[model samples]
Target: MVTEYESALEVAERLNRLTPGEFEKRTGLFSTGAEAVENAVKIARTWTGRDAIVVLGHAYHGRTLLTMTMTGKNVPYKEGFGPFAPEVYRVPSPYPYRWAGAATTETGIAEEAFEQLVDQITTQVGTANVAAIIVEPVQGEGGFIVLPEGYMTKVAQFAKENGIVFIADEIQAGLARTGDLFAVDHEGVVPDIVLTAKALAAGMPLSAVTGRAEIMDSVRAGGLGGTYAGNPVACAAAIAALDVIVDEDLPGRARHIEEVVMPRLKELQAECAAIGDVRGRGAMLAMEFVVPGTRTPDPDAAKKVAAHANARGVLTLTAGTYSNVIRLLPPLVISDDLLEDALDVLAEATRTLA
Candidate 1:
């Protein structure tokens, strides 16, 4: 563990440099992503004078008691975890690929449907009682479901009009992993608050909630932090990670991964009846396995493919509430040859499963 004074100074310096805006003073560091999100909710509640923190369906914020309540999936993440936190509502995510209609214009349908849902939520949840609405710019554990075009902007407008603080959970999609410093940047939408971790420190335990000045300051100073809120080692790693991402142009590298992976995955979809959808942005992508020629999920097939990939020296993770989707989170530092090799392994796995 890092000494308290040393950690404080390191965090102070880093936050001063990275969050030049008013956030430098308002935002507090946390030992883990879960803690950061927990405090973000606390701050939002205090700022809005509201009761509940609204979450979207298939969202995976964290695993702490409060966060486990916000996660949309059940089974393993919540089976033994009883009685989660209260006032956290889950709504359907903007999943265009599996949306009810067969229209190729998914972005349009998604924009309309999800916005309508948001309107309904605010009405029922009572705008006056709604503290905040948290969502992943790119739904991570929910299957790397990138929102349809204009989806987030419309949602942000809805949240703003309803006086609900919009929180962008960028834990899995930020820090050049999605070909941008932040995934929310892609839509040109500036959320009221942003949550990030994962690759922020290249695998270290650190997360942050940077946001509007007043909202962040709503909580009392001592109410927002932890003993090791910003460990020196993790901060050092984060600073290094930021340098590597900028100097080596990891955002461009992420784009390269998407360009190569998406096309090949699309080919698999055309060839195999069991391949349902290929989606996501940059290096953060996923392909859902389905029952042959149908949208019905097939976790068994996904499991088989994952096992095959592991045997072949490639690692992959499964996601989505149904666990039938394969999510690819290759190290942004992986070589082009290695990236291609992994994709090749995945392609062959798909063929075998098909």
Candidate 2:
């Protein structure tokens, strides 16, 4: 227990440095990303004295009952799950490829998306009755859907004006994975509660919820914890992983990855009719597969392409709400040669599927 406290303190100090302000920050460690997110909701509800939690379309938080309820997809993740937690509302994301059904300006999408979100919240769940607006700056399971420019800023402003806690679910796009310490950094939007996991402990089964000290303290001391939360071993691993991310400037590396991967995927899109969209940021990128000459999703193409790549020793994963997107989450420390080789395998796989 003494070691756990000490290690957690060290990890908290590291996280505070990355957070935007000098104000006191509170962090609660957990065993997985889902657990940490659930706790964030609990804190938001406790602090705001509300029950409704707002999430964006196609968002994937976790598989736990409450988090699953928060997820936007109905298949696979929530097929048979019954009686999910109530008061969770969803709004359309600024998905440029599918939202407006035509090419549009980023600024226009940002404004329109925000307006729709506000309208939904107002009509579906009153602001005073809402606890939090959870956002995945880059929707992990939603084809690495990066929020439109300025969209996040507007959402954060709305949350602040309406007294709703802005929760940034950075579980997948965080810790330098999106060319930023946090995805919201690109827009200079600081969330009230920031969730971290996946890479935080370098695969050591760790997750964290860091938020404003006051909001976090809203719950009684004994009200926010778990039996295995903040395990000493995981804390130590996180400290080391964080040190490496900073010392090596992993965010910069992610930018390099975006530079290398985006163009190649775009070129492939031009050549392969099934490649409908190439989007995402940093190492978190994806290509949404679609039927030729139309916008219909092509999950079969995505699956075949991923299988082709994996069979040849290059691992790839299929994602998105429709399972028509091949999401690429490469290791931040990957060598240039290895990345190029992986891309070659994917290119071959994509062409083969065609």
TM-scores, each model vs. reference: 0.93, 0.97
How do the residues 1-354 of candidate 1 rate in per-residue lDDT, one tens digit apiece?
Answer: 234556545554554444323333444667777887898899889999998888877888889999989998897788889878988877667788776644457676676667656676767776678899888988888888888778788888888898898898888888788888778878888788877677777888887777887787777756766777777788788778778887898889999889888899999889888878888899998989899867889999889999999999999989988999999998888888888899899999989987
Could you tell me how far off, in angstroms, the CA of residue 120 lies in candidate 2 after the best superposition?
1.2
User: In candidate 2, what are the lDDT values of residues 1-354, reduced to their tens digit?
Assistant: 324588988888788778655678888888899998999999999999999999999999999999999998889999989789988999989988888734388788888889989988998788889999999999999888888899999999889998999999999999999999888898899899999998999999889999999999999868877777888899999999999999999999999999999999998999999998999999999999999998999999999999999999999899999999999989999999999999999999998887
lDDT of each model, Cα atoms only? 0.81, 0.91
Candidate 1 has what TM-score?
A: 0.93
Range of the 10 consecutive residues with the lowest summed lDDT in candidate 2: 98-107
Best by TM-score: 2
Q: Single out the weakest 10-residue window by summed lDDT for candidate 1.
A: 15-24
Error of 2 at 113 (Å): 1.2
